[model samples]
Target: MGFGFVATQILAVSLPILLGWALNKLGIIGGDLDNRLSTLVLNVALPCSILASIDGAEALPDAGTLVLLMLATGVTYVIAIAVALVMAFLLRDTEDARVSYRFAIAFGNCGFIGLPVVGAILGAEAVLYAAIALIPANVILFAVGPLFFIDATADAGRPADRLRGVLASLKTPTLAASVAVLVLALAGVNRLGVAGQALGIVGQMATPLALLITGSSMAHYRPLEMLGNPRAYVAAAGRLLIVPLASLIAVNLFPLSPFLRAVIVLDGAMPVATLGALYCLKSGRDTKPMMQVTFLSVVFSVVTIPLVSLVL
Candidate 1:
């Protein structure tokens, strides 16, 4: 795909966010509607979207490539976590902002944004590799991802309490869907049937709804403030530029194919996952830093992603 295609896809993705913000500013959409949309996204749309992506066993790479992709993904997250840790140390502000920085640094918008970008720019085959990359990424995203937001510092006496919280959080529909996709694929179940088609249709709502919710969340804050603070900009720099550039250099040390390498780097280049804002909404945390960082990173990614792609 050309840079025009890249710009168009990003515009398509961004318009809803703008609309959501506009509607909220005009008082057309209210909190009740935002709550319902958030619930629909987290509980229903996101899970369906995930399952619908892997419609059959054929959607995955071959077993050998699958192992290689899994390993590459593992290494990718390892690098991501390392980067996030460094960021966490650097951006030591409020616990909330720190968590936002750490979470956004560690995960990118792979499933929601990267899949379509890769499919359009690379090819169908590369899209499949991208899909499989999400197996490990989502597992981490939904599994341990929330822990970043949770306060393990509260009580020194109860590690068990924290463990239980982590376990309970894992029961979310998104994580369940991830496990289901893996099991179904490994079992060689190759047909989603009419139900699958229905799921695929509903699953399409995930990204737009996520963007809208994020925008609505942002609307709660002042428009000028939503542009973000200096620390938030630092996080944006890491999300949009620093993290992906590191991945592009780091992944070359691995034995991955060129396509997988490109996918890994491009995945890293995606803007902050809207999932961060979703989690903030769910837990009633201040979505300030996340929303700010997400907004800046995504808008900058229009140029940043294309530049990174040129290198690839």
Candidate 2:
């Protein structure tokens, strides 16, 4: 069952790439479309997706399970960060390459890819647990993730700089949605009525639109060139295999429920976040290697996720 769901989700992620490739070939959409789609996904679709999934959660885990899942999520990221730093030093020659590689390894597409896969395999309750993971993931991605690109010229004099960065990161639409949904759920706002229905409609667009945008961006790259990067392969291995294996060990050492354990393990096995490369671009670092790692990790996770699922 886990394998079947994973196979279907992989196909779902890939189909948009094919569509984007075809559209690009026909001169229908360009880079501008990619940006527009990303904005929509981040600001609208993703938040709705979070709200839709969490608000309608039928089975909430116990407080212990939630605490355990959070711990596993934090530890998985710490290990990933350590692995990324070591891999960056050993594998990459240039500072930019090292920064990009480290960022790719440290983050995963836990929201867009993860929520759907977990929901499919472990059901809606598990998605709620996965969202708990996303809260910290977003914080780390926005705040500490950029520090990878900090060069000698970076200004660390002001404490306000770090605070401002964190504040800006927390203001994202998805985070807003996550918090809103949590509030609504706590307040017993079960029947969102028109708002819920509307969010559900928009939220459904997050995954396909995200996949399409990712595919469209990929259309510009030469597959042979991207695949030839050794760093990409190492990062993919770390993201798909090593991180999840570490997560499995951490979860097992605790007495967490099977469902909680499964959620953490599967999340650990997710591909690098598509936005990591974009973040690298924003930080004036190399995006090529980051993109390479993200694309290849997704390709490899088609196998790794299923195997990890079976093991769990």
TM-score of 1: 0.79
Q: Write the per-residue lDDT of candidate 1 for residues 1-312, one digit (tens) a residue.
A: 467766676667667878888888899875999888878877888778767766653555556766777777877787887888798788778888888999888889886567655654665445445666777787677766776776665543466875676567557776577667666666666588998789889977777777777667667766588674888888878887788888877878877777788888887788898789878876667888888888788767767877777777
- Give all candidates' CA lDDT scores: 0.75, 0.75
Give the per-residue lDDT digits (tens) of candidate 2, residues 106-211: 7788876777667656665666667777776777777778677777687654778777977887888877776665555555555666777887898788767766
Off by over 4 Å in 2: 153-157, 185-190
| Residue 133 local lDDT, model 1 | 71
Q: What lDDT does model 1 reach?
A: 0.75
What TM-score would candidate 2 get against the native?
0.88
